[model samples]
Target: EFARAPGTSDYAHNTFVDFGGVTAKNVRLTANSNWGGMFNQYGLSEVRFFSIPVFAREPSPDSGTTDVDVDVTLSFRAGREAAKHDVYLSTDEQAVIDGTADVTTVTEASHGPLPLDLGTTYYWKINEVNEVETTTTWQGDIWNFTTHEYFVVDDFEDYNDYPPDEIWSTWIDGYGILTNGATVGYPAPDWNQDEHYVETAIVHGGEQAMPFFYDNTGSAAYSEGERTFAVPQDWTKHGIKALTLYFHGDPNNAAEQMYVKLNGSKVTYDGDAANLTQTAWQPWNIDLVGFTGVNLSNVTELSIGLERIGAAGGKGVVYFDDIRLYPLFSAVVGTFSIHPWTGDGDSGISSSKTYTHTGKFTGEGTDGEPFFAGNGVYFERDTNRSGTSWTLTGAANVFGTTNPVTVADDSAALARSFFYGDEDNNHPVLTLMGLLPNTEYVTTFYTVGFGGAGLRFVDITPGDNLGYPTRVDQNGVGSGSGQLIKHTYTATSTEMSFMFDALKTGDSWHHYAFSNEAVSPNLGSN
Candidate 1:
């Protein structure tokens, strides 16, 4: 119940009450009495409702903005009745009142010099508060923003070509068979334009979107759109690991085949390829960790092609807009190895393998749970306490970020050897349950703890196993990378085990033990 004098004696005009942080879908004001009358008839001047701070302004990242700097300050306008403001920031969209308001400032409000995760989305809101009002808090609507890497592949805002008229492969849906090119420019209209016309256009909050056509009618086996783009920067040096974009598909059109080409190598979609949903405009993200072999740096050209393989009538059209590239986060890391071999008829045959995996390593202790891998290999923590795993901390070197792969330079640049000990005792362990009996197998791992300041590879888990003296082949530098310790051997029995125990011995440890982790297990054809 907000109260006021009800009516003004000065021209009877300035009578109002301020409600700080309250909102409703519908508001009904029931007046009891005023200065003009006792109960029935009352004089009221004006009423106003606000879902947000009445005068909120100057959002740091800006509403619906992208490519925001990692270290950004968030600020907003001062409320009309606000004595102070409660500000909140979060990566989670549905978060509510977690007690973690980034900052609450007087007069308008500002928070930061705050650090942000790279390649991530953030949601923030402001709530106005008044010390003297009956209601001191009025929460506002949530506003969102996203942050990107220092490097930007393309925003699609400025293309020297103006409109990519010649880029779309229009001949496919009989689009090329006709004449005036396939893909066309979509410039969003301001007013209520013709909905039936395909060109009234829906842009991704931009001036234009390049849309392609697909007929799949007569002689139209497939309806797809393809266009090539010349990458502007050397994203490889910038640690690019993910690709993102905005897409639009007609609700009337069903699932279709969608594929993308990076430097000519076909990289399949993470989702179902046969069912590319063409609904409202949405963002799609693709992680590059699983991409076996793709050169991200010095990337000259990229081609995007979509085919309507399962459309009911054989043809349909789709729209794609706003493509972006990103670096990895601190939580995601990849460590891998390359094996080039020659023998058996193909002497020059060479191939490489990567050991980077995306999975959670919780501290479960020795009595924790265990699960089997796709290869029927059962694995568990080195001990019962979840504390046995490697520690995540700032590095002694400058290559990585507090030992985070996704936030570091690249997979190879990670320094994984930060530990709490110099002793050879306590270490993280993992056992592989399914290995062939007496089978020849070679395993290579970039073990960090073993070769610390003065520690030997033998100091850690060398010839490590469930039980028994296993065959110890060799331990040495891999590629120009002297840090990667390659250990090979033959399986004496079925179950194989490994461990990370640099800190257990209580031996003198430094910032150098255990840089990062990369493992490779190869069972030669027997």
Candidate 2:
């Protein structure tokens, strides 16, 4: 049927031809003489043969929204009836529709969840067509949106003005004031210098810092400040690790100390006299590797603490600024292999399969992910005690186990060495990051008599400390001998690391010797 045939003998305007899902290759229409039998004639400005170009875009994330995932779906309303659709994505505004440009044609209403960069903007368009490539029914308009920026958790800059009720809603704490990188000083005695609390024009990232003056001379008090914010996107998914903040204050070189509490839990990491003694702004970072059940997506609070009985008679000032909670050290922790007994003990054995196509570690199994030792941008250990220490073992050592062993050799094999080897009475924690968000991964290893070896997974953005791999302080080696120790982790980030330490003397060979550790992601496939 003809598309523009309308009102007999009169000129046809605003007319449309509906083929009704007809598979037309070549269409031809014959014209007839005018009804008055006058010489046949007609006038039309445009002759359009719509072969099903994309007519409209479907509902999706609105433009300018923050904290969007890297993988997003592109949908449409009109393109569903078409045989195929072409998708184009670009950061450039003037993305063109040409034969030689980047495009993908698929037979679906929605285009790929193409991988996108973090904290970046993108432009996209869709064009619809039929199976037999004859015409373009419609061309979609250019649409754009920005991805999430999970790097800086807190800058203390997005608050209302300070006239009593105009302070930022980020915290509830001791005596303090937010300044626009101003030279803020507190009034105190001669021994009490307030310059340490003043940030002046120095800032880590943004234009604000909280210069807190703690005059703890009256009574023994706890110095703590807490914040209420949105759940930070999983930083591990973005290849970030550890939570960092900038601090400048006088050192508490004695028994007096402070600590950082995340998600209403106390970690082994705390400050000594050295932490408070710093006169210049420095980044204080804590490893997020082994905090129990920590997920960044559900993060709720962040806080800092100190003891009023410590140095300066608890009469000093500390400046806090830009308390960001993410670091991108994209890595996975483990030996990559589906089966450990199948490869050489020294060489890291992973699957022969490739992924989105980049570097290949020991990747195998259904999901094509490798066995993780631990993944993160960087791994770190912190302790306030002078003699405290932590280290990972070199390689797997063969040892006959009194306990039952799985896989290859019936004898047990040691994968890594003792955690927190020295100063049995102090706190030592190892933290790392780099994990996929809302994704599941598993860790299987062997340990013997590993006591006080607490584990916690952390949320990187805004540092929610109560994430995956919950606190397991006294988990034992399988069979109480050198056996396979396995635990599954559903992380809030790209990759997750952990911390372990010993608080007391070991029971013989029971100083937390871990071996044959394999970490794998839950990729569903054969």
The candidate maximizing TM-score is: 2
lDDT of 2 by residue, 381-426 (tens): 1111111122222211223334433323312223233323243333
lDDT of each: 0.43, 0.44
Error of 1 at 162 (Å): 6.4
TM-score of each model, paired residue for residue: 0.31, 0.35
Summarize candidate 1's per-residue lDDT along 1-526 as a digit string, tens digits: 3455534456543434555555546766786655545456664465665465454556666789997877788877666778877777787766735546455555546777766766678888887778787667777767888876534444444532323332232212224454222334333323355332123244553554546554544454444343444434455543566676655565344454555656556665544432233333444456655445666654645555554454333444566666776565221111112222111121111123222111122222343344221222223322222223323221112121233221112222222332233334444443444456554444433222233222222222323322111111111222122232333445555544444433224432222212111223454321
How high is the lDDT of residue 66 in model 1? 90
| Model 2 lDDT on a 0 to 1 scale | 0.44
